[model samples]
Target: MSHASEVPASTPTIVVTGAGSGIGRAATRLLLAQGWNVVLAGRTEASLLETAQEHSRALVVTADVSDPEAVQQVFLAAQSHFGSVDVLFNNAGIFGPSVAIDELTPQQWDEVCRINLTGAINAARAAFAHFKVHGGGRIINNGSISAQTPRVNSVAYTVTKHGIAGLTKCLELDGRPYRIRATQLDIGNTASDLLNDFGATQGALQPNGERMVEPTFPLQQAAEAIAYIAGVPLSASVNQLTITAGGMPHIGRG
Candidate 1:
């Protein structure tokens, strides 16, 4: 019988940004469990360590993706540890706040742009460069429901995710010759174990200025979706995927 996970002769190593927590951490775990090597990267060493602890196939790198230098170092460390990089999950992001666009500060906007958009750019560039040499690789950008429709007080996040959608298309076009394929996973609310303990979830503002608790799916489901995308042989590709809670207000706006 053919194995479900037929790891290629060349060891598959994936670099996951924002790997210290939330979706990144969940995806990293699923990837690792599926016989692929993983490089856990984020701003916090302690969290990365916890994610990679006792995992022989895991490499932990403390990287703040917004810093170009730091981002470069992450790929370098991954290449050094695993010999080559096969996939990069462009998944690091933050939700700044829910406020009126006029009330949003310049610093807040810049901060979100730097980490959400610029960070993905740096990582995508690095991965493309590496894939160019290695003949190809995959990059899965973590987009959001906001990418498709704007939510109140989410200017920075919405803008950056729309930027990600653009970036994914660009990569898909430019990387075709080299076998570098790109995909975007536009996810909705995902329940995080870490956040659940703290009761961190709150009402999300609707387009009509209504605040309501957003529906959420298990974080693992998103991780598995990512793994499925990453696992497909290079011959095939999933260009874009949107996985949101069944009742999330994404398909139609209020």
Candidate 2:
């Protein structure tokens, strides 16, 4: 609950994509409370402003991460306002249609890839450019449990998440000389608007083809994990971290 003391003497600035709601919103609030300046980026200006909550340190930047130019603008705006950016939270993503592979449309797959995979790549590239000049920076990618295991009828979402894992590894390897650290948080069943829409609150589809309600943890926990990783010094790095609801059927066979 308390991370203010862990923060460096100088205020750190972080750019969080998908800051409009869910984990991004939660992490932004916590980061602000911990004395970090955050630039909120997403497709909706209104939601990003809402997430800002009139915080003096929060800058709202409306951007669709799928656009490389827009993603570059998010970092540029952050630098213009905050002077510098210390971390990039690549969290903007969409869970495409949930249907069998044969039933899935090509457009649906492309949409998910554009946002989930390509979007993260764009942000990472921009951040890497900034970090090289600024000395060092961190990137915390919001990967999903689907990165490691796939659920029934979740081809698009799962594939993009797996792609994110690969992206994370590439960043880590490629950014070492420049002090750019990358970490992927593969979270599971965190309560969010997306989860509710996916029917987790009622019952989610199981791999066994059955529907069952799954336990979900609060958004604060996931946010806290992100904050912890963000606060770590560049001298050390957390390559990957997995946080999940204890009752979620991810650790073992359901």
Candidate 3:
């Protein structure tokens, strides 16, 4: 068979959290371009609408993933718009305060956990339930390389990302009977507002003062990688994937 014919043409209905910006935005655009209907979810309604307006198959829904009720509403809206959710890209997360653990405030700690770890759980809960009823789906989480080797002064973000690894594994096993697949993509510095903000807050400069954070990634590269993982056949699956910048310190424990 030709390579073109080898790829599946199943137009999946995809739900992407944190779709207002960054990797989520890239994923949404890529999926839409590939002829999939994407439901974009994020806290910013205006940005979400802007993303939706650009794509004929986009359905924008604004909701905070940390709030269970809001997450439910978002999913319901997605289902209503797309008939069924074939995949959920659980990308909504916060980097939290880039303070040393000792200096990190209780509020900052809680908020990060709420958005980073709990948000994934809540969205997965909703998505898994829907998949169970609707006959199966895929859940792809946006994990960080820091999940395994953390950066200094980013305890909360690191901890939550580590939790995501466990979550991905657990869900993968549990969803087997339903044919639902769960995977984690351990990302290393891709150019985005998150990295920009992280640099602003944490000083992305080394002691010698080299600038961190490239202006932008070939966003299409990472998005296409994820699109491939999400579009895999039910009989086979990509349980975990990692995509990172070539010069990123993510490969090492740095």
**For residues 150-198, what per-residue lDDT tens digits would candidate 3 score against the true structure?**
7666888999999999999999999999989999998877766677546
Give one digit per residue, the lDDT tens place, for model 2 in 1-254: 00111223267899999999999999999999998988888988878888888887888888888899988888877777678899999999888887889988988888989999889999999999999999999999999998998877788899999999999999999999999999999999898987865677798888787898999999999999999999999999899999999878885426
Superior by TM-score: candidate 1 or candidate 3 = 1
Q: Sort by TM-score, best first.
A: 2, 1, 3
Ranking by lDDT: 2, 1, 3
Each prediction's number of clashing residue pairs: 0, 0, 0
Worst 10 residues of 2 by lDDT: 1-10
Candidate 1 structure quality by residue, lDDT tens digits, 1-254: 00022234367899999988899989989998898888888998888877776577888878889998888988887777678899999999887755668988999899989999999999999999999999898999999877898766667778889999999999999999999999989887678742232122576566686766767889999999999999877787789999978787776545
Q: Between which residue pairs do clashes occur in model 1?
A: none
Best candidate per lDDT, number?
2
Give the CA lDDT, 0 to 100, for residue 153 in model 2: 79
**In model 1, what is the error at residue 181, expressed in angstroms?**
0.2
Question: What is the Cα root-mean-square deviation between model 1 and the actual structure?
Answer: 5.0
What's the TM-score of each model vs. the native?
0.91, 0.95, 0.89
1 or 2, which is superior by TM-score? 2
Query: How does residue 36 of candidate 1 score in lDDT?
Result: 87
**Which candidate number would show the highest TM-score if scored against the true structure?**
2
lDDT by candidate, in order shown: 0.83, 0.88, 0.81
